[model samples]
Target: MALYGITEREKAVTVTHAGVPHPDAECHGVVAQATQNRVLVVFVSALQRVAHPPAFADTDAEVGKH
Candidate 1:
């Protein structure tokens, strides 16, 4: 996961990557951030859903454990 962009209020962030979309296509992986320089990352299959800010610690903990 990588930092793609930041939100308008600067309270959120966006991370993006290449991933599978739906059952058939590749899509832009978008993750929301609201933390530090690394922020947070999430792979969103649906671009529309990325409009919200994603939790960072939860994502970090989940990925970090793995």
Candidate 2:
């Protein structure tokens, strides 16, 4: 889970991977920081609702343990 800070006034998105400013898309706010576990949980939950991917079922349990 990579953290990004998007500046609407400058229309730029900043990430830890690069020092260069990336042009922002149609977005409202920025994410200053995010935890890998939290992001993965949300991702897997969405996948479960839409695709129900088999691999992710096990991961759900693993994530809960953590």
Candidate 3:
């Protein structure tokens, strides 16, 4: 993913819950994945030009955009 110089802040914004995307939301998908340390507690607004960050560091590998 670093090959793209992709960062989370520019792509995904944090959300509170699994609500329908707002007109202002930019996410493309939502997935629930397991983590190593602990399960994550945040939601991500997916991006097409870049990949989204894991809800928790060291969770699944960063989820990619479609």
lDDT of each: 0.30, 0.35, 0.30
Q: Which has the greatest lDDT?
A: 2
Per-candidate TM equals 0.14, 0.25, 0.14
lDDT of 3 at 29: 25
What digit string (tens of lDDT, one per residue) describes model 2 on residues 1-66? Answer: 122333443334223223222222211112312333666556645544566333233333354447
lDDT of 1 by residue, 16-42 (tens): 211112211111333333332232333
Q: Judged by lDDT against the true structure, how good is candidate 2?
A: 0.35
Report the number of the highest-TM-score candidate: 2
Tell me the deviation in Å of residue 20 in model 3: 20
Deviating ranges (above 4 Å) for candidate 2: 1-36, 54-66
What lDDT is obtained when candidate 3 is compared to the true structure?
A: 0.30
**lDDT of model 1 at residue 7?**
28
Model 1: which ten-residue window has the lowest total lDDT?
Answer: 17-26
In model 3, which regions exceed 4 Å deviation?
1-49, 60-66
